[model samples]
Target chain A: MKISVQADAFDPGAELNAFSAGAAGAGAVVSFSGVVRDEGGRLSGISIEHYPAMTGKAIGAIAAEAVERWDLSDALVIHRHGDLAPGEVIMMVATAARHRAAAFAAAEFLMDYLKSRAPFWKKEYHADGAEWVAAKDSDEDALGRWAG
Target chain B: MKISVQADAFDPGAELNAFSAGAAGAGAVVSFSGVVRDEGGRLSGISIEHYPAMTGKAIGAIAAEAVERWDLSDALVIHRHGDLAPGEVIMMVATAARHRAAAFAAAEFLMDYLKSRAPFWKKEYHADGAEWVAAKDSDEDALGRWAG
Candidate 1:
């Protein structure tokens, strides 16, 4: 298991390759990447803020749960906080398991938790002004599927 | 959309990076990779065979269907045939969409089709002899979920 909460930009492709290489005995690998989207030409960029102390700990706990539940061989989560331009990757999750079902399920589970439950605040910038992005009802609904 | 059925080794990470770079306006990207698993110490390697003329066409058709059904920004599929050693990548599927749900669903759908419906044959080699690999009931059942 590996988790990183950093402001610096990371290469998703390079990280994925490294993760796959390190998963020695796994037969299936799944990855999900979330990129900042420009909703129309009105958007400029976005800024993400997090509680430094609690952010990593929270993500680590959820990732650990995913690993145990899915019997994953390995798992990785990387999230970026700070200013990000449209098309910039905001975060990524990867999972490895002996079977494809487990890997895919774990990756999806991690992504749902990160999107809806993670402690991150996002502010979207526009030409007129900037506003904090609100939690989406769709995201909340998506997260509900994973609830036990 | 891109589909390839080849015997030569390919870099999954490199391909993923290329695919993501080409997908403009997509906010979510998902990828699945299948690796050759060595079942215990008795297994040596495996050989995959495909119908040269129909393989690419079949994959392309399914990929196109996924893109239309899921409203995907892009989709990619790559499968390698011929002898493969343990830990080598056998195939990969990738999908990009404005939302994470569509991206994840399309990728999984592509994988299920590839696993059960794709025209590929496998022969697993052991220390003593080689035997033809048969389709699993689980894989068949997985495909049923996507049925119309």
Candidate 2:
């Protein structure tokens, strides 16, 4: 499994290629990407900021935990932190396994953890002004599904 | 999300970027790839062939089903219906969702349907000879998973 923090948009085909590069026995891989969107029928764009070292460390820890928890052959977590406009990418996760279930579980696991566990924060630039979006209680609720 | 059958390897990063292209509301997106493996300990290489029209139709049914089944914002499926080397890609599925679960579920569902329900046949080229591989009973069992 591999994890990274980058400043620019990544190429999904290339990233999938990289993860499949070492695949031999593996049959299935699962991945996810988070992107900035225009929401509320009004918000135009979003700008995000994160401490590079801390964000990378936190993502690494999350990936490590996933490796230990699942029978993954390969996995990746690439996150971007900086100013992003509507339709810009924020992050992505890819998981591979001998079977589809494990890949699915691990992919979902990393995404939920990244949302609730990562220290990186986001500030959306909207029509009114810049605002730091708080992590949702619903997001916490999303994590609940994993523990059980 | 977009799905296709190609003769070349795919880029996961690029597909993810495409899936998340216009959405700013999505906080997460998930994707999965299925690659040809020579590690069945049984094959020296892998080759795939399919009924082109049926393959596209079958995949479209699965992807459309996923959209109805999950809260997905976008989804794509690309598969190659020709010879592939070890470490070469066979197929890929990418998805975008508001959260991870839907993306994860839809991706998994798409994969399961592709493997067992889709209309494609894979032939393995081995040191001994070449033989077509049939979907295992286990693969169908895996399909029962989504049968609700």
Positional deviation of B30 in candidate 1, in angstroms? 0.1
Q: Write the per-residue lDDT of candidate 1 for residues A52-137, one digit (tens) a residue.
A: 99899899999999999999999999999999998788999999999989998999999888887789999999999999999999
DockQ of 1: 0.72
| Lowest-sum lDDT 10-residue window in model 2 chain B | B15-24
Residue B95 of model 1: what lDDT?
A: 98
- TM-score, every prediction: 0.97, 0.85
Tens-place lDDT per residue, model 2, A23-108, is 66787777676767667556677666777668878888888888778878878888787777776667778787887778788888
Evaluate candidate 1 by giving its C-alpha RMSD to the native, one decimal.
1.2
Please give the lDDT score at residue B14 for candidate 2.
67
- What is the overall TM-score of model 2 with all chains considered together? 0.85
Instruction: Please report, as a value between 0 and 1, the fraction of native contacts recovered by candidate 1.
Output: 0.66
